[model samples]
Target: MPAPYQPAGVSVGDVPGVAQTAPRPPLREDLNGLRGVAIALVVVFHVWMGRVSGGVDVFLVLTGFFFTASLIRTAQSGGSLNPFTRIGRVLRRLGPPLVLVLVGVAVATALLLPRTRWVDIANQVVSGVFFYANWELAWTSQDYLAADPSVSPLQHLWSVAVQFQFYLVAIVVVFGLAGVLRRSRGVHRASPPPHVYLVLFAGASLVSFVYAADGTSRLQSWNYYDTGARLWEILLGGAVAALFAARHPRPTHERRSSEFRTGRTALAVLGLAAVVACGFLLDGVNEFPGPWALFPVLATIALIAAGPDTSVGHLLRSRFGLWLGSIAFPLYLWHWPLLIFTLAYSGKPSADLATGAAIIAASVVLAMATVRLVEKPLQAPGGSIPRIAITATAAVLAAALVCGSAGWNFYIQRSVSDLQASDELDPFTYPGARELTDGATAPDADVVPALFSAPEDLPVTSVEGCIADFETRDAISCEYGDLSASRTIALAGSSHAEHWVTALDMLGRDRGFRVVTFLKMGCPLTLGTMPMLGESEYPDCLDWTQTVMSEVEQLGPDYVFTTSTRPREGGQGDYTPDFYVNVWNELTSYGIPILAMRDTPWLVKDGVVYRAIDCLADGGSAMSCGMPRGAALDPINPTLASSFRLPTVRPLDLTSALCDGPICPAVVGNVLVYRDEHHLTATYVRTLTSELGREIAASTGWW
Candidate 1:
């Protein structure tokens, strides 16, 4: 969360123990120390507590404050707002450290990470280097704050991305504001200059905050990384900075009284305490970049407003404080990747206390080295750093980083497209689920979705408009498998239901039945408050479910296909919940028969969930990479245990087709079982065509 987009004049002396002749303006050292403290919270909480520490929010505030204040001061001093100069200054300062991190991460990714993760990491590196990582993550809905997500080393760069984007907008705003101010200077002699800019920023902040507050509850994962949602935090910081710079030092002639100093100290103490306490008190992942973010924003403002005379400043200006601030940015860059790589190496989700300590220590050392080798060289006087030349050099580095990954991704896109187009697997080579269900054997062959091609391997429902996204209630439908066939099977539910559509589609085509998909991303027609796919606000999900069910009922399909039972949370058993039964009973009341299958196993080990391809690329054997069958499913089918099983609500569990007698391997019969944590790959699902076909005929007699 710590970003290096600081005020341009941060000299070598600002780093701890470095000597300088020129003294700093007020609060610079204090803000720097705050940066250090924020990064400390981020690293410690990320490595050990596995929770957001509100430190990223703090960085957002500081970054806005520093950049805006610096820009204004430049304007006040009659410096030109030349776009090239502004860009050059930012690039010259930021480019080296960023490139260094990218290059290092690229090398580490190739050497240390599984090949299944390489393309993703490459995407991350390119996005991080180009300063759009936040948007990339937002669009993908990568749960940034999940306890054990597919951890990326560059994930923290989202803050940097947001900040960099803010800088670009701020530059354009400043240019426009300067022209307006120059024209109105004499006309507005009665009023202060900052009021216009304040109104502008305040308006923008209010609009952004409104959108963020509404968005956070509906689609929190996207809202978390959305620049529009997050811009208010940075804008408010800029607003505060503008007010301070225009107002200038509050009459330096005034003496500091003892009571005033005590109040300032109390205020500073309270602010610091509030900032540190925020993460422990609030769920930052779900509640942040919204109204709750004000806690940290106000807390940071309080820290800045406390003034240099307070003991807080005395403390921040101390040796250790400066040292911490010096390495904050690099420490943030190093820590997450180290923590993730450590987890991958150990095959554990969280780090032990000893591992946490070592990661922190190594990060600090690397941060220090970066400061000396990269940052210090850029700042050193004799480096003769030509701003434009370095900007061009940095631009070249960024372009190279982008193109390298882009080329690889281009090849992947072309290759994956061809593979998808020619997707029929030879039954003898890729038996997949058939091996589990029918003891099908195949000639020895590699996995159908090669490690590089596996991540993109997904079901037919992946196409846009096939299913409603988490934020929308539109009953988006897509038809597959003999669209003209008279007998229709309505596929309704969440992605768990969607994954099975591939097999159903294959069955529908071969057997002259139509498959109509009415799906939502994570909503599985639950009417009660229970966690599904780690999401929230079931009201919206409930609404979407009702809409989809109504659409299916109106269509009056011969049978409705959905997932009947889910693997119970925090246990080694799958079960039909009262919520799912609510949906089933409702459908049955309308005289529609339900053909529901048991959910697939979510492969987890040592607290780390395994995506099938990643497991294989991590050097895990097919048998070894899988969870035991007993770990995810009950001895007796849990649907049979459900008290609400109406006779019309037929349960068609195919656990045998998804798992072997004792185990569900990540790979089966030379094909990857899952594309991600639990979604069956289209490649794998295709292999289940015969198995699903036979089951459907027995359940609905449609075949």
Candidate 2:
């Protein structure tokens, strides 16, 4: 968990802003208690509801508030800001528990996770150690093929990265502004005027807010992890702190007035209520860092402004709250990985209520132990900056070593797999798709080479710029098979439709028909806009579909092949979506026949998608890893129903070749069936060449 801002205390007495002549305010135990409450909400919401709590937003505000106040106070007291000293303090507070947790998670992953997942976990460990997990996730989110039910244990570290980034930015801004003020005045005043800081905060917040709001609407997945989009929440806290500093404290007589007390009490109560309500009322994961984040941020600001002696404040400062707050950082660090590992081990996407409670209980115990045994000793008083720097450097080196070893091992495994694939093994034992439909027994699934290919082993057509990604709009044409052949077959659609190109390319070479591909990563040939993972409209896909349709029409291919059916939500079997129907109707009007291939079974079970390599590496045999035929597919092809009404549309389904009587095996004829959750592997598809060619010849009468 990202650490909450430490309240002002004797530890920071040397900072420039404190007035040596006047007694400083006592450390705010109530704010610490607030941090405890925030962590509680975060853990419970994550474990039981699988949603984000607005707790992180509150912490971001508190972090900005305390950090800004310290800097402003230092500037006011005529002390120059020391970036190294400040950053060292922050590292001492955050680094120990984070490193401990990373090492612990790495050990846990090695013990519990499958071999196939080791590389990903290692990558995450390195990224988290270096404070770049958010950037890594942003890149991963853009890949449509990377979606999986298995959650990374280090996913929570994205917030930690954001917090560290803010710390760096805040330090630079404070020092830079103070230097400018000194130069302009020619006389060193303690600090710049409060109004100057206020103006700067306002401008920064407005820009960040607008960027966040607009980006959320356009690309929420990218925005979710974006540091720029989240700056306003922290900046708002700085603005509040500036306002508080500008006003001198009231006289004792005025401060003790009954009216003042009543107003403060009332405001504190309302603010506390709002803070608690946010956790329950809003879906923080979906609504946040955007304008919707105001709920939690404002509630926190209200609580801070209400001061410490009110009823709500007293409750927050109670023994339980203070204790929770004390351990909040370590608790946050331990809980997420524990929860994710528990779910993975249990083979459940979400834990039941009892299991969730147990997980929370376990996390609390581990967090307490971690703080007492690891964090406290490292952050003990009199620790030198040089010592801390050495420790941090050592930790980074250790993480890099682990990551490097994992990458080397992964490369070796892939190299071996590639080498085996390139060699000609006995065709009888490694009999591709022939064993599935031709009564040949598949070799034992355990001993098969190339049983599971890495993501890089996808078809050349799928990887080599032939398949346009989400951001690409223009159609990229790639020719395969017999380029000189007079007859041409156009393959156009998403990766699902593109997977069959391996088989079609082989057929073209033998049958003298040129194969032209117009492939996009995840976009099907549809007139309607495709909805992306974050519920944002895929305008690029829509625009690209129009472009491809025109290109295909102009090429005037003998036959255009594309997927024609999609699985109905919360229903059995597949159906032709209206978008597919619209495209087919238009294509047939041009008198060019449409080859509507039935889409393959997606290996999703009980809402959790299973990856073939993960299943195989987790000791699952072909029979154990395969999905039930009835669960994955309808008994009859659904596209046949829609195609019968259209004269130029021909439905070609090869489900029998992919599935046996009751099971759709992950490995058919000793060849891995899927590259990921939904797309077929090139190796398996290539084996379907003979059957696919025969079907096309019969339908088009061109061979």
What CA RMSD would you report for each candidate? 4.3, 4.1
TM-score of 2: 0.89
Using TM-score as the measure, which candidate wins?
1
Q: What does candidate 2's lDDT look like per residue over 448-477, in tens digits?
A: 344333554567686577888767889999
Backbone clashes, each candidate: 0, 5
Clashing pairs in 2: 1-333, 16-74, 17-73, 17-74, 75-190
Residue-level lDDT of model 1, residues 334-354, one tens digit each, is: 888778777767767788899
Estimated TM-score per prediction? 0.92, 0.89
Local distance difference test, each candidate: 0.77, 0.77
